[model samples]
Target: MTLAHQTLALQTLGLSKSFGGFRANSDISLCVARGARHALIGPNGAGKTTFINLLTGVVPATSGTVRLLDEDVTRVSQQGRVKRGMARTYQINQLFADLTPIETVGLAIAEREGAGARWWSRVGQNSAVVDEAEALLTRMKLGEVMMWRTATLPYGKQRLLEIALAMACKPKLLLLDEPAAGVPEDERHDVLDSVEALPQDVTVLLIEHDMELVFSFADRISVLVQGQLFAEGGVEEISTDPRVKAVYLGEDAHV
Candidate 1:
């Protein structure tokens, strides 16, 4: 493989998916470089979610290939992909309301270590796991409420915890689906800061409708329109592209 290929954290070739009579994703070939902060944006029905599902192996593609860290993972199961260093957070967090952030993250860490079966018995007893969970939660800006029940924390903190849970797997590629969705305006900054502060070694692919977050966090951007790639470029290029403004971003959109 070429050095260029070696540097890609994720790549999809002609990746497409369909359900019954509907085509949710067309043939899409995209690349995300190692440690790159890439954003995928589109209109409401532009199929961004379906594309994320395909990447995470939550939904199988009708055709095409998915490669994670340069290895073919097109046929890998969702759990298989996680084992191979690919992790994702959903648009709507799937957190355990009754579990504390520490417990949630601790279980994730244990699962990554192949000790999930004994996680309940080992959570507090395993100093290594506990330490790592604490450290991860703190990094995600949930240190102050690490012991609070998830349902009681603010929405933004809950979102941060979801990211923290994904991080526990030590993934090479992290897919964040709308980390700022449903957050109060005042609390949005916490989500932004936590995402920006993520380690450079962990490449991030963000799918968000919030333009402000996309512009702030993404160095590279891809605009998907009607399930096909409409444009791809650096932030300035996309922000200034007149066609993008016409179709997705309103004419009055404040780039």
Candidate 2:
């Protein structure tokens, strides 16, 4: 309860969510310090995704306080939350198939910054917005295929595009749901780096299955098991703890 030194960017106390007879999240509490790279790891059914839904207002929290920058956001709607500088990406690729990659990213920037208000007015015409979108594409490593239709790009590019879209919002914190999932094994490293390279002021809370990426990126790690928080610790402590290894790491020895 005492968060004096915590400098929490986002915090949840005694959070829970239920669907009919099933409890998706139970008494889950976490504090992500301002600018911290926090990673959440768990087995397949641990309710990691559901927890994110509750925080982002995609689903209402059954009971709890959700705070952003020390201000309560438990009841704020999703769209309102985005305007307040919260953004996220999904497990599945979410992009406009018919639009060119540049156009799609352009729309996201416009939506977030209100620069793309004139839809019928030439999308690729705004010099400032186009410059910003192109830079984002380059930073996210999607420059080579900037002109390709989103649907035509490779899976990895599509995934990167989603991140770019989130960045357009200029969010203070980004919630990434399994970013490396479905990305090629060889390309996972770069994708992880792209995430790390994001603005230091932008805190990240990610759900990831790749142990190597998780251990390398997370400043802190929290384990979820059967819809409850099993443990929370700094990177080294979580990686070495026997209980964490038993439940989440399994046969894979700690890296």
Candidate 3:
């Protein structure tokens, strides 16, 4: 493989998606470098979610190719993508509300370690799994609430738990869809800190409307508008560009 291919965590060429007569994503190409902090930002109805779904194989593209670690995975199923080291969090966290953070994360780790069928039985019995889960929860700032039921934890903490679960997958590429959405102001910082503290070897593609998190977390930013890639550049350039500002202004979205 060429150096360029080796260095890219994700690459999409003419990636498009359509639902009947409506096009949710147009022909668009995007590249995220290995271990890069990349953010995808756009106004509501900009098809950001659709694009993310396409990347994760949650939804199939109308036409395009998705390359994860330079391997064409356009026909790969969602489960297949995860097995290939791609993991993601939803805008609305899908967590086991009844389970404690430790149990939840431990199960995820066990699953990754191929012990999922015996997850509950191995919880405390497996020292390696439990230890790894504890360390991941601590890193995500959930050590204090590790034993609490997920539903009882604060929204921000629940979000952190979701991230911790994803991290347990040991993903090479992590897709975070609006991690800060619905989080209260006071709790937002913790979420941001947790994101910023993620392991550098894990490439992050954050899809968020919160400009604060976007600017703070992304080294590179891509702007999507009406189902197409409108702009892409370093944080400074995209934040200061008049055209980008205009697009956000029209949608009453903060840049």
Per-model TM values vs. the true structure: 0.95, 0.92, 0.94
> Candidate 2's residue-wise lDDT over 6-96, tens digit each?
5888989999998998999999989899899999999999999899999899999999888887788998999888888889999998789
Off by over 4 Å in 1: 119-122, 249-255
Model 2 misplacement above 4 A:
1-6, 116-120, 249-255
lDDT of each: 0.92, 0.87, 0.92
List ranges where model 3 is wrong by over 4 Å: 119-122, 251-255
TM-score of 3: 0.94
lDDT of 1 by residue, 1-255 (tens): 688999999999999999998989999999999999999999899999999999999899999999998899999999999999999998998999999999999988988988889735745898899999998887888899999999999888998998899999999999999998998989888888888888999999999998988898999999998889999999999998888888775667544
Consecutive 10-residue window with the lowest summed lDDT within model 2: 246-255
